[model samples]
Each structure stands twice: as C-alpha cells, then as structure tokens.
Target chain A: MAGTDKQQDMLAEGPAIILVEPQLGENIGMVARAMANFGLAELRLVAPRDGWPNEKARASASRADHVIDAATVYETPSEAVADLNFVLATTARPRDNFKPVRGPVEAASDLRSRFAGGQKTGIMFGRERWGLTNEEVALADEIVTFPVNPAFASLNIAQAVLLMSYEWIKTGDQAVTPPEQALAPAQKLHIESLMGYLDNVLDERGYFRTEDKKPKMMENLRALFTRPGFTVEELAVLRGVLTSLEKFSPRNPRGSGAPER
Target chain B: MAGTDKQQDMLAEGPAIILVEPQLGENIGMVARAMANFGLAELRLVAPRDGWPNEKARASASRADHVIDAATVYETPSEAVADLNFVLATTARPRDNFKPVRGPVEAASDLRSRFAGGQKTGIMFGRERWGLTNEEVALADEIVTFPVNPAFASLNIAQAVLLMSYEWIKTGDQAVTPPEQALAPAQKLHIESLMGYLDNVLDERGYFRTEDKKPKMMENLRALFTRPGFTVEELAVLRGVLTSLEKFSPRNPRGSGAPER
Candidate 1:
C-alpha cells in the first residue's frame, strides 16, 4: 500500500530533486530512498557516470523503486532543467555572484510560494567530488546551500538529498501539532495575588536587606514574573513552591511548628 | 585543519547523539558521519546488535575517526543517557501519552535553549526496524519526530540522523550569511513618480475601460506597488519598462515618432 501510486498523493507535491553528473550508482540509489522518505517522487539525473539502468542503484534504493523507476536522464544540466520555471542550484561552497544565496529554510519558502502560484520548480544538486560548475549554476534562478560544521563541511550526496527533501516538506507547513502542552496564560490579577503572598513571606523571613532597596528589588521581581507571561499551570506550580518554602522559614520552622507524628 | 581538535571548536558543541540497540554497523557508521558533519562529537551506543568493536561500522564512518573511535558503549538505554539532564526520544510512530511530541524544528529550539542554560542534553534513536519501546521513550523528557510522507514514513537509521543533525546546527544559528542580494527599498517619492508614469502609459493604452471602475483598479494597483515595497532597482526597472512600452503606443506611433532605427 505504501508503494502504490494512489498513496503517494498523501503528501504535498514538491520541487524536483535533480542530480548532475552523479558518479556512483549506489549514491543514486540512496538519493532515491531519501526522496521517497520526504514524499518527493520526481528524480532527474544528468550525465550519470555509471549511466542509467544500473543494478547498483536498484539494490541500494531499498523499496523506493517508484522514484528510481520513474527517474529521467538528460544529456546536460541545462536540458534537464529547461522545463522548470524556477531552478535553485545547491552548492556547499560559497560563490561570487549576485544571485540570491539562501539557506535551506528560506529557499524552501521561496519554492513553496512559487508552487502556490502554479509554477514548476526544481533544485539542482551537483557532482559528488566536483559540485556544479559556474556555467551550470548560471542557469539557475538562485543558489541554495546547507548548514554544516565549517571545520568538517563535507556532506555525502545522499545526505544532502535528505536535508533538502526534508526541508521541502517542512517549510510552509500548517500540520496539526501533538496535543497541546501548555495551558492558558496566568491572569494579571492572579499573578499579582501570588506576588503579594510571596512579598509578605519574604518580608517575614527578612529577605529584604535594606529598606531603601526594597522597592527596586520588588520591581525586579515583578518584571521577572510578567516578562514572557507564564502559563497558568506554571504560575500555580511557582506559587506552590513559594508556599513550600514558607513552611521551612526560620520564623515558622517546619521541624518545631509540627510535633513528631 | 578541518579534522583536528583545534578546528572542531569552530562549531558550537551540541547534545550527545545516542543510538539504542542499533542493528547494523554500517548504519552506525553513517550516523557518526552525519553527527560529525554538524559538529557534534559525543556518541553513545547502548547494546549494539553485534556488540562493541565492530568493523562494519568503522568502514562506513568515512573519516570521522574522532567520533567513531571515541564512542562509548553502555549496557542499557538508561545507562546510556543517565548523565544527560534533558533527553529527547526520536520515533516515527506516535504513542498515546502526554509526552510533548515536537517536530524537528521546534525540538531543535528546545534543545538549544536548554543548551544556553548549561544543561546537558541527548537525543536517542531506536532500533532500525522497531523504533523506541514505550518504556524506552518513558526515559526521555519529550519526543521528537521528522517530516516524512505518512504513506511511506520509513526513514533509514542514517537518514534519520542526517535530518536531526541538520536541524541541530540550523536552529539558533547566528552565523554570517552570504553577501546580501537585496537593494534598499525605494523612497516613497521615487515609487510615486514611477506609479504616475505607469498610470499615464496605462491611460494612453486604454487599459481602463470604465471610468467608474478606474478608481478601484488604480487603487488596487497602488496597493500592489506599496503592499510589499519594491526596491530602488525594482522601481527603476518598472519605469524603464513603461518607457519602453510607451514607444509601441497606438496613440503615439513609434513608426513615425522619430527616425527609424
């Protein structure tokens, strides 16, 4: 059921994943698997070193034969992307060009918006050892790259496919999230009541060192409680914590306040 | 330089990546490569399928010897993540529980914020086939999952690592971007000048058929131009387009406007 064409429509259709001069068939197979995971079915290969119809790619593609079977081959990168209205070339290295260079997230939004307008889009991935040449990148509308450790910037071709494909499905998404984790924000009146209780306890415990500094310290405490607006549950837990501390106060010692049961 | 310890510090240190009862050594190797690409060095393995000191994993790990050689093996999943203060379990399948299940991007933010607070964190990936047991997920503080086609939601162990590692580096990033591609916005006066020129040309071209609807049409045009303010270069191009179109106007024939080219 997962391999059928009918079920493939469950995920949104996305930009093409094009590979230019990919050397190894195993890498091609891995790229197919990556695309399948992200709901991207269209795969384009240009001047593959091992050529099309190779058995190695078939063996490595796991069960994602649909992407590999429908994969198209073209003579040049230009001919491969000629039908695409917009093309973004992926390169690991920075280039000296005026074309917009965006990270994966921003580029995903650009592709998604263009998709909404009914425009066809494609992202080009260059060769394994030698990435896209300047001439080939010139054919693209923009440049899109990845985020890797500058110390070890290398990303295998299959890994690069996974990153871009993952972004293609994630950007511009409005999917339902898991069950709500946060409760409603605490009301100002409720928070002020808790603050007053805390202030009274702190005064009883001699937490205020100086009379002149009391107002400034209280102002800081108020800001901390109101800064980002904690959830009602969070506020409740905080109040309970202060109430627990009040029982341990020296003025009302917990060990002496209650006799041994 | 890219592989040395001194160079590793170029990227910020992130959470440990823990694999629980992984089945394949090659998959383990690929995970190391993915983590190294994103500047994460800590790796912990819990009861690997073939036990410790496996040759297949080493062969698959590329040249990320720092991560592969230093990996520590533990007896159980609990022992593997015992030292970490915050833990996230990665799973493709959902469970009927209250644990917050976050998408990769949001989970990345959660991890990074805790990182800012100096709390140690780790993310656990389960067996290649079975994924995490409910009991194993119970050990984690939250759950993190990927964006994949629900029809074909399977992600190979290595591919899953690549997606999470990519997000680990991207979230909360303050890295330098490539040279800016956009020019400054056009001054309001300059934009209005081009708008006037465009109105004149459209009037000469009889673009407005009804006088009553003209105001609404022009109002739409004004909003279109100002809604997302165009840049100076954009305004210049718009004016030039109108100037070029003015020549072909039927009212002012370019055929007899001046000398022929």
Candidate 2:
C-alpha cells in the first residue's frame, strides 16, 4: 500500500498466467516480474511444488509484489482455469490432439479481441522440466507454442511467459511509459542559440584555423555537434560548459569575444 | 554437433547481443536461451563478473550451447561492439543524452532493415544492478527500452533479451515453424455425413425428447460441433465414437440404429 499507488489497476483485465506445478520459487518470481513488466496482473498457481507464500519468490520478484500478493493458488489446472471462458495451454511440443495452435502474436491478438468481447480468457504455462502433459493440453480451447529450435526447444517457464506477456502488451491497448526523470527536448531555436554560443567561443580560441576553410570547418563542427540531436537539458548543460570556458579568458571575461590573454 | 545440425546458420547474420558486465551466470544462461529461442546467434560479453566458461551458465542454458559456445568476450563495451555498424543500448530509465530512443519493436525493425542493407547491427544490454553508464550509452546510435510499468519497471536481464529477441524474430525473414504434426482438415461433406449418422443414432436413442423444441436443440448442437472447425483427425475420432455407440443397439447386429436391446 505504501509503495504501490493504485490507479484503477490498469493490469486488472488481461489474460491470467496460470503456472501449473511450477518447480522453482525463483522461476515463479521471475514470471511474476515478467508479467508486471508487461502490465499483466492476474496470476494463478496450480500445485506449486514448494508451496504458496514462498519467501524466495517474493524476494526474487523485486517489488512486483502486487502480482505475488494478488496471486491465487489452486490444487489442479482445471480448478485454476474454472472461471475462464477460454484457455490456452502453452507447450513446446505438439500434442496428439486437434486443438488449434497459435504463436504468441496471434494468441495475444485473440486474447485482446476476446477480452474486448467480455470473455474471461487465460493462458496456461506448464512446468519447468516436462512441460504440459497431453491430457492437460486437452482441457484448453487452443494451444500456444513458441517457434523455438526443434533440436533443443526447452524454454524455462519465465522465458515462455515473457514472450507471451511481451506480445500481449505490444498488441493490447496498455500504455507502458519508459521510466523517465529527464527534461523535455529543447526547441530548435534554443539548440541553435547554444550552438551559436559554442561556435563563438571556439572562434575566440582560434579553433577555426584556416580562413578559406573556416565556413566549411564551422559547418562540419555544427553538424557534428547536432548529429545526435540535443535535448533541452543537454543544451543547457553545454551552454553552461561553454560559459565556463568563456570566463577563463581574462580580457574577454564575460565572453565579449575580445582578443585577449 | 550430434544434436545440433548446421543448416547455413540462419541466426548468423542478425543483430549482435552485447552484454556489458553481466553479473550472474544464471542470467547469462537465460539470455542465451532467450536468444536461441528467437534464432539470434551472435553474443558479445563485456567483462562478465563471474568470468566466461561458467559451468553454472552452461547448465542453466538448457541446450543453447551454441550461443554460449560461440560467445565472444571483450574488456569494454566499445570493444565488444566495435565491428557493428549500428548499436542500440537497452535501458529502463531515460538518460541525459541526445541519442534517439526506440521501443523494442521499432528498434528490432530498424535492426532488420539495417542488417538487410549489409550493415552489422547490435544491441547492448547492461549489468544486473546498474544499467549501462551514460558514456557507454552515448556510444550507441540509439537507446532501446521496454515500455514497462513505471511503478515497478525493473525487468531482469533475461526478460529484456527475450523481448528484443522476440521482436527481432518477428521483424526478420526467418522460417520459424511451429512443431505441428497433424493432418489437414476434412471436407464439409465428411463432417455433414458424420453429423447425420450421429443424429440418426441420437434420434433412435430419444436424445431429442420434446418435439416442439427439437429443431432449435438440433441447431444448437450442430453449431456447437461446428464452431471449433474440426480437422480430419478430429472428425475421424468423432465418427469412431459414433459408430461404437451404434453397436449398442439390440435390434440391429451392426449398429443399424434399430432400438431394442
């Protein structure tokens, strides 16, 4: 409650990530982290080997406590997905069933459309080692598989969830903002002013050596400075540095551009 | 070599994955697994904390041995990606720099298009504790980030790699076949014939009791059966079940739908 500022719970309405007999607490924690990273909230655990309220899982979750805290535990996969209208069981290998198989993107798209239609949809992930059994795969409406290397297609539980969650976030309408503490980019005029000031200081330092090549050299210098595109804060910092250098000239103390000391 | 057959290396020519001072062997292994899952081959390490050839890493990698085996080590970030024409640094937080910022999808598309133009492209991932230094990020042509939940945006190293690798695979022209060993769907006529046979059997068994509601009930049952669009295998299985049920009739020896036992 202290760290988490709840704002209508943007992650409340996505597909449930039901982990069936997940082995390691660390993997579960990592899965929760991945889910949180992609704004997926609902987490259902079916018969975890190490039991519930796992300390190791909470520790590894790294402040994704919301996912862990709100997690629901069930005894079987059927019970885990009982409330959902549609379920997708994720498996690496193909099963001997006729269920439609979807890649992550297509599955996510389906999940988005289904969620929009008020359908309670969930995606089930199997265990770390053996993956989902054919019987377990039969319970789902469809199967989801990662197009992994056929020779060695064993993906850890968290990795599989991450792929699905990433696609879900990408294809869904959630707005995930990159964490930022920086200022907005400066206007073009502000950047040009910074460049003009720097050019004046460089000229005073005789940085433009050849008279005939001065314009081209100045143009190249300007191009180089502006190549990466300066932000407002960055331009301000550059201006501060240039002003500092300008103060170093004794005769032109305030950067008057007088030929001096 | 026994398990992994070389097939002109579909993963060889894509973007490089440069890890800068990655801390854990488990994370490295997971990263390799994520890369292999998406067919990204090139891995460059910049001074890993536990050093390379780590047994823990190899063990955790599952069978992404090629990613770990062909991994290259360097002393610095610049040295790690020195051969690349373009580099994108991954970060959770925005840095005070002038580099262009792109989300994973946009970045992967750029990587794909740039690699198509014969330019070697790479993406840099930072350490576990602290991300890439500002100087390290400055060396990159652009910054790539996961559009993650700002409230708790700390994604583990492997999750970052998986998202990027997934995008790379999505935007690239690699043949990623889902492991499907099933038959094509049956014809509409076949399904209709099966349905008619089953209807006759059910009718003899008095499954449709009320005459007034019989048509609506039959229509609903037909819709339910047809909704999933059964494949040939599924239809065959259904037909076998129907025939087995028919054999229970007493009046007919070979399930002729004559009621009486």
Candidate 3:
C-alpha cells in the first residue's frame, strides 16, 4: 500500500536528479536512496562508468530501488536537462567565471516554489573523482553548493545528495513540524524572556562596560540562558533572586532597583 | 616558551578539569593534551584509581606538561569543587533531579563570563568505565552534556575534552577573526545582493501571496543565502538575473530591470 502511494507521489511534483558522468554503481545507488529520502524519485543518468541496471547499483540503493527502477538514462547532461526550465549544477569548488550560486536551502526553497508554479527543475550532481567540469557548470542557469568544512571539503556523493535532499524536503513541506525532542515552544519563550530580564539587570549594574564588546557579551549571556531551555516557573524563580539582590544592595537608596523582595 | 605561558595562564584563569575517578593515566595525559589544544591548562584529579603524576600521563601530555604540572589532587568531588561558585558536571545519562543540562557551546559561554566576573567555575567530566555518580551531579550548579548520537555516546575522555575545548576556545576568543581562505569578499556581497534582488522581484510578482507566510519565507530564503557565505559580486550578478526576469515578465511592461543587468 505504501509502495503504490510512493510511486504515485513520485510521478507528481518530483524534481529530476541528473548525475553527470557518475563513476561507481554504488554512488549511483546511494544517490537514488538520497533522492528518495526527500520524496524525489525521477533519476536521470548521464554517461556512467559502471553500466546502468547493474546489480551493484541496485544493491546499494537498498529500499530506494523504486527510484532506481523509475530512472531515465541519458546520453548527455544537456539531453538530461533539456526539458528542465531551471537547472542547478552542484559543485564544492568555486568557478572562475562568475555565475549565481545558491546554497542548498535557498536553492531548495526556490525550486519548491518553482515546482509548485509548474516549472520543471533539474538538480545536477557531479562524479566522485572530480566534480563537474567547467563547461558542464556553464550550462546550468544557477550553481548549488554545500557549506562544508574547508579542511575536509571532499564529500561522498551520497552525503551531498542527502544534505541537499534534506534541505529540499524541509523547504517543500513547510507545515510538517520537525521531530519534537525536549525543547518546546513555551519553554523556549520563557527562556528568551528570562535572558532578556537578566540582560537588563546586568546592563543597569554596568557589568558589560565596553561599547564595542557589548554585542559579544550579550550573545554569551543569551547562549548561556537559552541552552538550558528553562520553564516559565523556573524563570520566575530566577527573576525573584535578581529582585532580592537589587533590594538588598546598599547602593539603591530610593529602592528604584527593588521589587516586592 | 609555550609551556611557561600555558602554566601562567592556567594559574590565572585555568579551567578546573574534574576527572571523576578516571582509571587510566594515558587517558589523563591525552585529556591534558586536548586541554592545551584550546588554552585549557588546569587539571583536577577527582578520586582517580591510578596515582597522580603518573609517568604515562606525562608521556601522553607531550609538550603540555604545564597542565599536568599544575594539577591539583582531590580525594573527593566535594573538595575539588568547594572553591568554585559554579560547578557543571558532564554526563551522558539524564538524571531526574539533575540541574538543567546545556550543550557545550552554552556551557563554555557561561564559564567564560563567570570566570571574567571573578567567579570560580569548574566543569566536571566523568570517567571511562562508569560516569559521574548521581550524587556527584547533584552538587553541580548545572549539568553539561554533549549532543551525541544516542546509540553511540561512549566518548573517550580526550575526545570529550577536545570537543569541550573547541567550544571554549570559540566562545573565549569571540572577537578574534577566523582565518580567511579563498573565495573573495566581493563575491560574498554579490551573492547577498543577488538574493535580495531575487526576493524583491518575487515579492513584487505576488509570489508570496500570503502576508502571514511572508516572514517565514523570507527567513528561510535568508538562511539559505547566508549559510554558504557568498561574495558581493556573486550577489550582484544574481540580482541582475532577477532584474532581467522582472523586466521580461508580462506584468512589468517596462525594462527597468535591465539597468543592473
């Protein structure tokens, strides 16, 4: 029952994933799995090193064989993306010739909106050994790149695909709430307000003096307060302590700093 | 030279390294090395199974003997933290009565500010075999926990110290500019401008129909743009494309968008 619905969903509103000169069948399969993760099913293979319909590719695809089965084979990248009104080429390295580059999140959001507007979009990923050639990148309307650690920028094709797909899925499903963990809405707000009150009190005490240093100081304070995810009642108790301190301080002659403490 | 400065710094504002009954001397030395990696030099031994000042620890410390040299021996956890105004106990398992837990980033920020204000702050980490006892955790003002994969939370002492040190160094040196790599600054601004232009064009075209949804859409777009850190020139070119699109569209009869293009 899930399989049928998945296939139907794949047929509708899915972007075409074009792999350019992919080397390994394992990578191809992994890419298929990644595409499936974000509800993308249409895979277009453009000139592979390991032949299409290979068992290795199918095995690597795991449960995402539906995407592999539904894939379209293409002789060239241009052919694969010919029908696409919008094409985004993925690369880690920057191009010498300037082109509009968007991060995964922005590109995903744009693609989601465009897809909803009846625009056919194709996101192209390069091979493992070397990324997309200069000529190949020039063919796309826009470039897409992932923000990765510079020291270890070389990403396995599947990981790149997964990150991109995750962002795309997030942008596409705006209403779907992410998995709920410990932090909730009320707790978050209460924490923020508590931090705000603390900041105000600290500022009055001249704790953070340097003008240039204020932003960092406040950020450090906020980071400390927000991390705990305090409840409303917990915050109220903290505020009471602050009020008691203000009242007890001998400097406050008129009790302007004091509350009902 | 480095060793002497490290020792002096440790004496001045050294972070209290509480090892809760750590078994191995090699692990302690590795922790010292990891601490030195981020300017943390203070070493506190809390009821270690192995005797203090072990040769194996000195060997592992390598050039970071300053940490091992200034190490303070403690028979109990309470004695180790008696001088500290704020004490944070690190653990993987959550306790019901434990003070609210925070991630490393928040904990580091809190420690930095507290230390700056002349408050003695100590962060207690658990041993390899068995972590900090619930009774030990109850003595802490806060609990510090790393966000690790739940299935595999068993981190080596040195690795845990390294992670915490990384966060501490980042928070402590908040004003220090990160080392610049390739990808020119101009390109970054260009990317920003291009994103702005695209958003404006989309807005003018009524692409964002719902007023309520506009802020969220814009925020998502901003997140997408900012994540990759684009150059100004890149942003400018992106904006040019948006301008061209706005000019060519049927709704906007004028060619005003061509100016930037």
Candidate 4:
C-alpha cells in the first residue's frame, strides 16, 4: 500500500504476462524484470510450482518489485486469463491445433489493436521443461511462435518473454528520441566559421596543390562538415584539434586566418 | 581447423555481438543462449572481467554450445572489432557525441545492408554497471538504443543481447510457417455427414420446433463445423465432445443419422 502510485498501473497498461506452472522462482523474477523493461506491469501466475512471495524470485527480479508485488496467482490457466478478451499462447514447437499462428511482431500489433478497442489482453507461457499442453493452448485465441533456428529453437522462459515484451513496447508509436542531455547543434554560422578556418589552414599547408581539382575537393570538404551538423561542443573540439595540429606547424603560427593571410 | 565447415558460418552469417568488459561469466553464457535463439553465431568479447573459458558461462549458456565454443576474445574494443567494416554501439544513456542515433529496427536494417555488401559488421555493448565508455562509443559508427520504458531503462546483458538479436532476425524476409505435422484435414464430405447427423439429433431433441427458424439455425451449424477445417484427429475429438454432451440428453439416444432419422 505504501507504493500506491496507482496511476502507474493504468499508464503502463501493458498485457498481462501469465506463467502457467512456472518452475523456478528465479525465472519468474527474470520474467518480471523483462516485463518491466517494456513497460508491462500486470503479472499473473497459474499454479506456480514454487509458492508465491518467493524470496528467490524477489532477489532475481533485480528491482522490478512493482510487477512482483502486484502479481496475482490463479489455480488454473482459464482463471488466470478469464478477464482477457485477447489471449496469445507462446510455444516453440508447432501445435497441431490449427490456430492462427503469428510471430511475435504480428502478435504485438494484434495486442495493440485489441488494447485500443478496450479489450484486456494477456500472453500465456507454459511450463519450463515441456511447454503448454493441448488443453492449455486451447485457452488462448491464437498461437504466437518465434521464428527461430529450427535446429536450436529453444528459448529460455525469460528470453522468450523479453522478445514478446520488446515487441509489445515497440508497437507503440514511440519515436526514437535523439540522445538526451546532448549538446545543442551548432548553428550554420558556427559551421561556416569552422570551415573557413580549416580551409585557410589546409591552403597554407599546400594541401590543394592540384589547382583545378581543388574546387571539387573543397565542395567535398564542405559536405562532410555540413553533413554531421556538429553540436556546439563538437565544433569546439574540432577547433581544438586544429589548434593542436597548428602547434606543430613550424611554417605558420596558430593564427585563425591563413588563406586570406 | 577441425571445424572447417565454414559454409555453416556463411549461411548463418550475422552481425558480431561484442561485450566490452562484461563482468560475469554467467551473464556471458546467457548472452550466448540469447544470440543462438535468433540464429546469430559470431560473438566477440573485449577483456571479459571473468576471463574466457569460464565454466560458469558455459553452464549458463544452456545449450548454445556452438556460440560459446567459437566465441572470440580481444584485449580492447578496437581489437575486438578490427575486422568489422561497420559497427553500432548500444547504450541506454544519451551521449553528448553528435552521432546519428537509431532504434533497434533501423540498426538491424543497417546491419543487414552492410552484411549484403560482403562487409562484416558488429554491435558493441558496454559493461554491466556503467555501460560503454565515451571513448569506447567513439569507436563505433552510430548508436542504437531501445525504445524502453524511460522509468526503468536498465536491461541486463542477456536481455540487451536478445533485443538486438530479435530485431536482426526479424529484419530478414522470413515468413511464418503453419503448425507442424498436424493431422490430415477431415474431408468436406465428412463435414457434411457430421452436419447432417447434428441436424437430426437437434430435431429429435425438439430443438428446431420453430419451423421457419430451423433452416437458418441449420445453416449456422453447417458453417460452424465447416469453418475450422478440423483434421481427422480433431473431427474425432469433436465427435467425442458431442457424444459426451448427448449422454446428458435424457430424451434423445445416440444414433448414426441426424435429421434423416
């Protein structure tokens, strides 16, 4: 009750990650962490082999206590998924059930659509050793399998959960934000000044000996500098590099102008 | 020289997964398992804190023995990626460097293109605690970050490896295969016979006494049985379900023909 930030529950309204007869407490812990990594908070357990409030699981969660603490346990898979309108059963071996088979990416999109339609969704994972039985697989609406190497198609419970969870979050229109806390990009004025200094320095060093070809070379140089749109700090670093190189120049001093000089 | 079946390497050719100064052998082992799940084989380590040939990592890798057995180690990030023509560094924190940032999907596309051109590529992951140093990140071409929950952005070594491996595998033009070795579908003639039997049973039970509605009801029943394309085994299972349901039907007895009777 102390961590009653209930708003988090609704905001992170990701699909419930259901583990049916999960064997290890450590695996449960990792599953919880994987869910947290993708902003999924709801967790359900159907007859866990190890009882709840497991200390090992808590330790393994690596601080995803929100998912661990709020986890609900059920006596059966049907009860675990009773509230879900859209359920996906994850399996490695192909099933004979003839249910629509989907990959994790497609399943993510499906879950997102269902969630938007005000439907509660969940994913069911079976036991560690074997996997979901035919009866258990029948509880879900569809089967979602990974496109793994046929020779080595086995994925540990946590890794499987992470793959699905990773896609679930990826389905959202979350644009990739550029690096945060990064320096602002340098203005065109700053880039032009840096380019002028570099041109003067390069000309002084007789680097443009082929007279006619120098125009295209200068164009290429300008493209390279303008392309990256260096940040303010980066422009300074470039100036520093130029200054350090000029220090070794016995022919010219550290003066900013060279071609004009 | 012993395992010179290099063609397997080319067919399963994937970008190298580099761990820089990873601390634990167990973590490295899980990383191998994660990579193998997506059919990635190349693994490079830069000065693993626990050293190579670690028994803990070997056991932790589950059964990804090929990846573990062939894993290469280097003294530094540079040496580790020396043979690679392109590289992408993964990070959670935003760096001040003015490099172009990409999400995992874009990074996977980039890797695929480089791989197509016969150019080797690798992805660099930083240490567990702090992550790739600014200096180490400078070694790569660009940064690829996950669109994870900002509230909890920390992904353990194996989870990070899994996300990248998953995206890499998804970028390929792989199509989803249907379930494996399922029973042969019950013929359409069989479905018609089953439907006709059901109609007689329902009529005998006085379920279609509403004469005008009986045709529509029978049509719906036919559609239901025909929709699933149940296999021979599945058709038998359905008959079993019907038999069990009929046992409770006090009035009607089990008979071969349906509405005909």
Each model's DockQ score: 0.49, 0.26, 0.01, 0.28
CA lDDT, every model vs. true structure: 0.76, 0.74, 0.66, 0.76
Over 4 Å off in model 2, which ranges? Answer: A1-8, A174-261, B1-10, B174-261
Per-residue CA lDDT of model 4 for B222-255, tens digit only, reads 5456445465578778888885676644355455
After superposition, the stretches of candidate 3 with alpha carbons farther than 4 Å from their true spots are A1-12, A175-261, B1-261
Interface RMSD of every predicted model, in angstroms: 1.3, 2.7, 11.6, 2.7
Q: Share of real contacts kept by model 4?
A: 0.58
A75-159 in candidate 2: lDDT tens per residue? 9876786667667889886665667779887888878866665667789998888888765665576788887744456678888
What docking grade does candidate 2 earn?
acceptable
Q: After superposing candidate 4 on the true structure, give the runs of residues whose Cα lies further than 4 Å from its correct spot.
A: A1-11, A174-261, B1-11, B174-261
Per-candidate TM-score against the hidden true structure = 0.65, 0.63, 0.38, 0.65
What does candidate 1's lDDT look like per residue over B112-142, in tens digits?
7767656678899999988887667756667
Off by over 4 Å in 1: A1-4, A172-261, B1-4, B174-261
Write one digit per residue (lDDT tens) for candidate 4, span A1-261.
234266444436778999999999999999988888888988899998989979999899988888898899999876787666557889986676656789888889878865665557789998999988776776566789997766567798888898898899887884433333544345445655676787788888888887887765665565556445366688899898877786645566556446223
Query: In terms of TM-score, how similar is model 2 to the real structure?
Result: 0.63
Q: Kindly state the fnat score of candidate 1.
A: 0.88
